[model samples]
Target: MVKKKKGRSVKKNPNVNLESEELTQAPHSFIIQRGLGHGHIVELTRDFRKLMEPFTAKSLQEHKKNTIKDFVSVAGLLHVTHLCIFSQTEVGMYFKVGRLPKGPTLTFKVQNFSLAKDVVSSLKKQLVVEKAFKRSPLIVLNSFNSDTAHMKLMASMFQNMFPKINLTNVDLNNIRRCVLLNYNPATDLIDFRHYVIKIVPVGVSKGVKKVIQGKIPDLSKCNDISEFFTRAAILSESEMEDDPNSHITVNQKLVSRGNVEQGQSAIKLTELGPRMTLQLMKVEDGLLDGIVLYHHHIHKSEEEKLEIQKKRDSKRKLKEKRKQVQEANKKRKEAEREESKQKSLKGMPKSTVDKDSVEERDDDVQYYREEVGAEPDKDLFLDNNQTKNDVSKVLRKFKKKKNENFCKNKEDKFERNKQKFGVKRTTQFKQNKSRVRNRLVGKTFNKKSNVKRKSK
Candidate 1:
């Protein structure tokens, strides 16, 4: 009686129920999470993103994109040989996935560390699945703070992540020793990029202690250790020529011991000790790298030695020929200078007969005597008589003309002197009158008296 009966209300359902029984449903598409986290999920559908494939025309074309028209993919099969990271300010990191050695590299830029980490993780997984890690030893070249504790941390992380592969630091020297890759660390950047490791061929020799047996080789028997070394060097050079791959590396201690007086005489064998090692030369990245260690003498064949000697002899002969040619040229030049001097003196008069001219005259006389069977002395005398007569006549004429010119010049000079020094009668009279007037004026005479006296 105190409360009215509560009215029950029905709750409305937001979901509508179909009246018709026939229902059509869309097919469900399944998605597999790559464990790349939420940040990388969108990368799955990127146009440039692709999975590595075996090298084939179809596969290569399929992976190619028009977005980057200038991009050139690696020539060989697409494989992930290395993982590299670059630090950037605007973007957190830039990663590169290298292909085989000398092949093209693919790159991706990430704005955050988390996304970069996921991308790298995903790449490593793919590499493992493809068995790319097993083909070659993986070398981790980090350009990041090498002296800091962070490097150690990064190294540890890489080791833990890539346990199946052998991860090592980037040592250019050591790498050079092993391979012939054309990589220079001093001038090259290694940060934020993966490099395909090109293995080098290198040979390491045994320790010095092992190479030298009981006592050092005796050098007393030889006059000087140099002779022995010369023989050994020749032998090694010949061996190297025979085998292009062969190299020789001699230890300094062995050389010094061979030079010692005690070792020189006692050493009988021509070859090096058994403990030495000979390594073959290997090419890396189109470059020759590494050294061979050896402790023995490898001589060349007699034929090869003879050929070398012949070549040296030929070179000597060529040099001698060149010297002879130069000497002949020098002689020809001297002859030309003499000829030019003679031509220059041909028209000029001389006070005395030149020695060269005398020699030439003698030669001419001898030639006339031999070829014409004539008395050359008599002919020369007659020629001189005629020439002397002509010269005397020319001198007489020149002297007469010179005398006439001298007389004429003397007369002209005498006339000029007489005109300059002798005074004229009229000029003398004017001068006398002016002088008298001046004297009368100085004596205080009147102008009228001076005029009257001058007039009288």
Candidate 2:
């Protein structure tokens, strides 16, 4: 055995080695491993796997695709690389190399990833052969911005291709080259070339529309790219007036027809884009027609009908509203008239009477005084005999309104007496009402009833 053992045997039992693997396990260190808390690694691994799943073998190697790699490269230059999962367009798994920042993180401009991928792959492969992309990220951005629907479709396709992509890996910074193309079929030339088409909410581009309208908008005050787009224009007067962002400007020289002149406005496309144009088409009850690169939506009759309908609707509504207001006013007026009639009835036969008139039968005893003998104070007349002071006191408490009736029978009798005597006294007259106070002695019936009535 000693003689045979002279040669050192490196081979060991596979089963024994496998069993010892547990004993000699690799040492785990680093903060990531130290207090990883149970299952943290599992969770991290799961997330990493999920993140990597989106960059599939197919996605990365699809040479025929308007590859996401090309989009990422162009977007990286613009510093908007955060659009990896498409869902994480704002923020996600962001990786940076050194500090000489690359480009935009996302390229939503490319219509079809597959087509773009083909072009990019071919170009990249050729570039690689030429050693062009070895030092630089290939920045290719092609924008088919005329069709939001198309762009949305493209986004869906990307989502389908990379369903498991981790949204957290998205970056949105370092935007690079941007290519914007609006192909006009009528002229067969691209319109308003702005390669750097910064993405923003549609609302932000409203100001750009105004700018295109020759309003010379305050670009310095712009808050975002959308604001710039909203205020942007086609940079030509004829194109500025055409609205709804649907019309395509054509150089008459490019597509010359006897009727069509250079720099002249043409009915080649709709004023508004697809959405508005579609709505306009429905109004005309006609199907939309597509041009080579631009969309030509013909709906003149529909437009006229819409205007007519709008006017008719406005008039109808106005008439209805006016009728309602008139009815309300009529009711209010009727109510007011009824209330006034009732108020007139309430003061019927109202009176201001002298206390002595209830007892006195002789009209000669009654007296009404005048101020300064000749000046008659119309408001101070007494109904029966009463002292000036006494009548004054009563009149003070009971005001004589224009609607009051002051015991006209007594007044008539007094007038008769004056006529019979054929006398008009120039001196101030006064009568004593206390002498007729004896009239009230027999008026009361029961003390309890009187007290209750008085309380009421």
Candidate 3:
């Protein structure tokens, strides 16, 4: 082998142990001068395979432990087109992400102003990018704000952002250019000859200074504008122009003076007397002619007149008969009512005997017999002094007692027959029972009672 240099030999085996040497070594001049400053050198010892190892195992139990807490499944990103900010408070800002047809709406709560701003900016950028990439037309409609100046400002901003797209107002079609025609009120008729004509180019100002300084006049006061403009336009053309070629004029002179001859006579008052006589003769002649032409005309005979009188008399008699029948029916109804009252009263007690009256009568009879030491007359004892007030009081008491007895009997019958009839009784059964009871009571009073005749 060739002999190598000592320096080369030492450099070739640079990994040789140096701790065994006793000589002290000084720090590097670069490190001392920079005072712990390191050069801009980066070291990368990344193992991408080792980093992604946890995500590689799909069925790993430990990885599955990291569950999603609050997750919302987005059906489609395009459908989430509307972003509405509902509220902004100290705690957080609330907003909804939704669209028409009202599908799933996602509400987001952003914590800070900076974060909300960033999120809104990102959303706008995404929307713009999506619109551009898809090449879809966008229509912006605003109805919440009515200020025209604010609307114009918004329109300018939108135009600046979407330079390639067409921007128009929602009511663009409704905007109209109304040209008010000048009117001359001095003339009663519409004067078309002196109309002030104006032709304004689209998007060009006639007088910019005047427009800026002038106020918008009320259109309600300009009713004659349409009529004036129409009349002016129609009458300004050749159709209304006077033409000498179509004009015609005539002139005439009398040939001769007519002579007044004495052949024809003028009408006089004296002639009217003979004319009236002739007219009277003509009227009489006309009447005679009419009578002769209609000779077969018939006239009413005496027998026919008599027959008409008889028919009138018969109609009067029929009306009187009908009135008499109606009167008889009314009287019969009154008599039937009286009879019904009498029948109803016949069943009621004639004289009511109250408990106090009965006791007083008994005490009076006993006192009279004891004091007189003889039996009192039966007729005098039985007869009590009766007055109109006493009769009314007796009637009232009798009515009350009858009503109480009737109600008690009705309730007792209903209770007794309620079980015999099933669980319920129909209205027909109750009505039939009432009708049968009324008929039986009416028949009971009609029966004649047997009485033994005493020997005279």
TM-score of each: 0.16, 0.16, 0.14
- Give the Å shift of residue 363 in candidate 2: 15
Error of 3 at 219 (Å): 31
- lDDT values of the candidates? 0.36, 0.33, 0.33
- Model 2, CA-based lDDT: 0.33
Tens digits of lDDT, candidate 1, 363-422:
878888899897766546334446789789999999999999999999887677668765
lDDT comparison, 1 vs 3, better candidate:
1
Give the alpha carbon lDDT tens digit for every residue of 181-241 in model 2.
Answer: 3444344332321121122212223454455445666557667756566445524455444
Candidate that beats the other on lDDT, 1 or 2, i.e. the better one:
1
Summarize candidate 3's per-residue lDDT along 1-456 as a digit string, tens digits: 999756646656766554332111111000001111122100000111111111121122222232211011221212222222123345533333222223223333322222212333443222112111122122233331435442333333222221133244222121111111122223211110101111111221223212333535333534664543333333334324233343322121212112122221111011000000000001101211211111112445678757866886798899999999999999999999999999988875545645556778789999998899988885554434555557788899999999999999998887778767743565558766776787787843223333558999
70 Cα displacement, candidate 3 (Å): 84
